[model samples]
Target: MYRGRRRVSPAVALLLASLGVLSGCTNAPPPPVVESTSSTPTSEPPTEPPKPKVVVAGIDELRGGFNPHVLADQSPVTDALSEIMLPSVFVPGEDGERVLNSTLMESAEVLEDTDEFTVRYRIRTGASWSDGPPIAAEDFVYLWEQLRRQPGVINPVGYRLISDVESRQGGKTVRVTFEKPYPGWKSLFDHLLPAHLLKDAPGGWSDTLDYGYPASGGPFAIRAFDLDRGEVVLMRNERYWGPPAESDRIVLRAADRSENLNALRSGNVQLGMFTADASTMEALRGLGEDIQLTTMPRPVTSTLLLRPNSPQLSDVRVRRAVLAALDRQALVEAGTGGGPAANLPAHAQVLAPSQPGYVPTEPSGEFADGPDPERVARLLTEAGYEHSGGKWIRDGAPLNLVIAAQFRETSYEAVANSVADQLNAQDISTTVVTPKGDELYRTMLATDPGVQDPPRSAGIDLAVAARPVSADSAATMAAQWGCPAVDPDTGRTSEFNMAGFCDQLLQPTIEAAVTGEVPFRRASERVEPTLWSGAVALPLYQEAQVLAVSREVSGVRDGAGFAGPFSSVGEWVGAPGESYDW
Candidate 1:
């Protein structure tokens, strides 16, 4: 994600003020300073109070107690907060390169052995949690144990490969040994919980840590979390080893896109991050000089995931025909408000266009940017499908497919509608189903056990979803396509495979990538063709990450993917000449 600032037009500034503007002055000029005549002829002018703590909106909800390890509660907001309040040994830079965060770790190195790989991290001196517990190797061990034992933790695939962890140097050094060479080892340990807090819980860490974590080690700590009001307040961590946070308090309020926009226009929030559709950007520009827009290439790809084993989609020809029937460019244009530079049509599913080692692959056949009716008809016919009365038929039944997507994200809903419309127009009977809350989770992972059965049985054939690829493309690709891991004790399969897709042909490439046996570019190139051949996921486009900040809010940095905007919160400064009291 690139970080560049663009100023709003003067006309837009006037419009924003008329809509609902926050006053330029936050503290009413401090009553003109009162001259201080009674203070025995004060020798020096009073120091200006700090500006009001910056308020930011656009957080969807405070879930999983702001813990990254908690799978169910992980959201954009929580991910952002985790980066601010947890220990991150390495952080992804604006260009998707890894940068060391020296406040958390003094140094990190990878040592290769004959049979295993060893990664060591040395804790920074005087690194302690807000509650007085010094950060130690035990925290890393606790994190690994919790993630290994609990399958519900998100992104546990890499941690599962770690055979053991050893602590040395008076508990200041942590050594992680992997069974084999893991290329993505640098991407781990971004969020580490304090082991002392939950080490003695009777229940598993996942169940016992549902509530929000109250202590923190990073630049900020949680001060209050009012779930009823959907608001969270974070104060600067006094014990932080690095430079203190710029703002005295950072307030995050849960609001929808529309609410967040209104909050921005009204000055209730100083910074807001959302999808900068053309209209939204235009609106912000029209609101005038108060707003500043920053644009970055989103690391997420909007995708249409097809069920692997569904009888209807089992045929490669049918899948290819379905892909050929939709116009990907049109879908992207509509989703990004016709801003060509804002989004790009995605051809590869494993790595986004902006990521390193990404090579663009062309779509198979003549389906590149098309609603190719002739090609669709020809493929369908070759696959034993017949068109009668403007509806496709196969095996004496109408060719009906259900498209599933979550209703919570507006972009997915729009993409799903567009895809469904395109298919329906091409003689395919299509139904768009949007589920929310528990139903939405079940719909997304329906193929997994206890998720209301496979959605294919419910006539759902396609799903519009968004998948985030990490800077370490190897680990991400492996997690998505590698064989599922089965627990020896429980005889249950891990839920890491969302599409229930397993191809022996692709597994070797994935394995090579995961184990650093092959170069990332070579492995990615090798796997891309096979993924396209299977037609498991049709990538629509790479969404752009957009954030609107007030003119007074400076030092805001853009983060990679779901890391959000708080990666450099220590440098964030509010309005000038005002001191923040609360």
Candidate 2:
């Protein structure tokens, strides 16, 4: 239901143009050959040759430095290794709707006679690690144990859905069982690591400019890495178990947006990721036959997080007043969408309609117009606050609030400013604080009640964050709202409920969604209303993973329509120029 914004990374453009070098975007005709004349004969026997496959170039800061244990800052690096190293049970389509198959275990049904919540799995019998070791139950058990120990490993996105992961191995069979029914069980398909290789490896795994991430389980492996030069190369695995991957090798290079655009135009690379300004998108659009450009949606949302713990924002009235004043639709229109931009407004709860537990709520009428300073003044007065001249007095104190967001993203900063202006009209002072990434995260981590060792307050009032939803389920929606999750800071049961907000009324519905014996779909229908009424997480547009491919390449399709362009890589192939299959 939510039409997402197009993602166009610079690297995607370069790759599309590179295909022109291999073969024209339009099919190329056979080359004319000079025949040998009066050649003394001889053909003893004829030998058949192998087919030429399409070679693509991907962009990752470090082709090999991706780690499953650490918070991944490198999407490109993860995308490159996803096919080989990452593991998930199901993958989302380009549209951020539906699911796709990966290394599927034969059966995933819960066992009826089992002592606990166990599900039987018949892992693809022949599945093997990149090092030729067979993929078995032990690997899963080991990985889960390792993950539990390193709880700080970010991207716990969908991983927290499970209560436990137990495995049984005998001969070539492997069974994975869960402690509870994780509604979005299909999300675990993106990446799986090799337990044997990392079992004894110190510090789990890491990436550096000089070293690669780890051995892969996908079609390619890191053949070369150079951090100083900011580039890496991938070669096809000759002993791949499944149908040999279409491409034997893919070369990836790192470059800035400008450099990536230049590469696409000159045909130096065959594929690139593109995300730039409107002018940049327009420029690439005019390139025509030289390179092919297509837009895909990425499952990402941009938000303006409000941190309430700061001295200036201790009052609940200030926070509510801020939300009441700003124009959310205007912000969505100004910042998102393609060209003029088509951003999915976060008027309702965070999850898209396509996602489970999604209930559409009216945006225009839900809250009042543009921070009505007069209205805010009334609310403050009701809360025992008085506006004396220009300053607000709450118990003889000034009414002020501090908002935080990273300085890099101008859009969020603009949102902060707009909110500030509206709140200011009511005589409530607002300060917008912009910090760098590490500084901001550390500040928030220490102050946020959810992630801190000992939460300073009821969690930062608000913090803007983004995560890819790997599955469509009610649990996913709840996680985004920060509900029912264990609060690391307080050692209390809390969801990412950063607002330190909860509704006892909604708990039963949420519990039903989580522990219901009925199907996940049924549970979702039953739970959506509770979230809608509570105003959980505010929704935002779903951004796309911008991917550019050369016309010479064929059979490329994304599972979630055009959003996740890499969802369908199994059928991709090289163009049949002379003798190669296109």
lDDT of 1 by residue, 1-582 (tens): 123445689999899987544555465553464455564653444554445565465554554445566433444666667778888788876665787777788999986553568998899879999998889998898988876556434556678788889999978999899887787888888688888877886654644545566578888887877777777777779998888887777777877667888878887788876666677667767768788777656546777887675668878888888988998777777567765334566768787776666667754463555788888999899999889999889879988877877656667788888989999989898888886523443335435533534554344578776666766778878766766765534777655365557877778877887788887788878777778878788877877656778866778877664456787777887653333243
- Give residue 269's error in model 2 in angstroms: 2.6
Per-residue accuracy of model 2 over 226-319 as CA lDDT, tens digit each: 7777766666666456666776555567877667767776666667765534766676665577566655544445555443333444455555
Alpha-carbon deviation at 339 in model 2, angstroms: 4.5
Tell me each candidate's RMSD, in Å, in order.
13.3, 13.4
For the record, the alpha-carbon RMSD of candidate 1 to the native fold, in angstroms, is 13.3
Q: Predict model 1's lDDT versus the native.
A: 0.72
The most accurate candidate by TM-score is: 1
The runs of at least 3 residues in candidate 1 whose Cα sits more than 4 Å from the true structure, single-residue gaps closed, are 1-75, 93-96, 112-115, 145-155, 167-171, 194-213, 227-230, 254-268, 339-342, 364-368, 388-390, 436-460, 488-493, 559-564, 576-582
